[model samples]
Target: MSDLQFDSSSAGIGEICKAIICLEIAANMKHVLFDRQTAIRLSGMSEKAYIRSFNVMQNGIGVKNTLDIKELAIQFGCVRLIPLVRKGLSLYRERFIASLPPSRRASADFTRPVFTATGFYLCAKKHKLKVNKNKLIELSGTSEDEFSSVSTSMKDLCHDVFGVSTEKKDPKSVKVNRDLLDVLPEKRQAEDGGYSSDEGKDV
Candidate 1:
């Protein structure tokens, strides 16, 4: 890390952004992209403002050695926002990758979609459960503010969650991939791309 003590308080948002970039390098988390979409959802900031704040933090205190950036840790609450420790995440991602069989490792970067809306609806009904549209939205964590596209996206998530996904449908339904599922803070499984919470132990 540079020994430079930049007085970023006087700088504009652009400079603050520079601080973030500098911090990412210092923290050695270059491969892991900041999850802006998740942040936007949690922060309740407009997309434009979210991006701007991220930039400012990066350029300001990130480059200022005198400031106690660690305090932000308590403020943000979620550890995910704290600058990543590259060594730790690297060890984590690598260990999980190694645990996967060759085939799964090859496809870790891509996610295939699971099912049709009708299939999901039928499956839910078969379980003697009614598919409340609002309930679906709650489970999917999507907004009803936007119409058609949002609806379709939630349906897709629901289809996957219901195990109605036709693509790469693993009917045998093994325990979810430990690598993918285990990495979450709570060891969670994917429910074969569609069902919700198969086992509390798994996630």
Candidate 2:
């Protein structure tokens, strides 16, 4: 607690108390449903500060190398669709891990963010959410091309594993046929088969 740099004032003390209380409740109610924003609000601290404090506590408790998908969703502006993201991650965990190179598979230091970003992007598309592709790539700390490749692989995995079709259905098109014709004005003839006086003459 002392290592966590909280302000040494009355308000800071209050904030610390609120954070501890929220943490305690969360620890006790492991199965209770709650959102990340709700916990942050209950902690009476800014989102950044709350996350920092929470990470400190998490490390103190010997919990290491954890990735918070909820926080990632929040960063990607898809907090409401976290369930779908989680489902994708859960379903594709093994396949994704297996596809990685041996070095990366061993450490998995950079796998979480890549998978999280891919899951979030897929979920956003499935749910028809208007998420910015560039923003998601930026937040995931991945290049646009890399994100695109992962997204494509994840989409295929989704189809194979979950039977969810990720291909866009094109609208049916109808072909039309028409005959064009040109019409000419009728010409008049005289009784003797000669041209009329008015015929072929400028008015």
lDDT against the true structure, per candidate, is 0.34, 0.46
lDDT of 1 by residue, 3-85 (tens): 25444334323444444445443432322223334545565655444433433343334432111223322332423323432
Candidate 1: what lDDT?
Answer: 0.34
Candidate 1: residue 149 Cα off by (Å): 30
TM-score versus the correct structure, for each prediction: 0.22, 0.40
TM-score of 1: 0.22
Alpha-carbon RMSD, candidate 1: 16.8
Q: How many backbone clashes does candidate 1 have?
A: 14
**Lowest lDDT block of 10, candidate 1:** 110-119
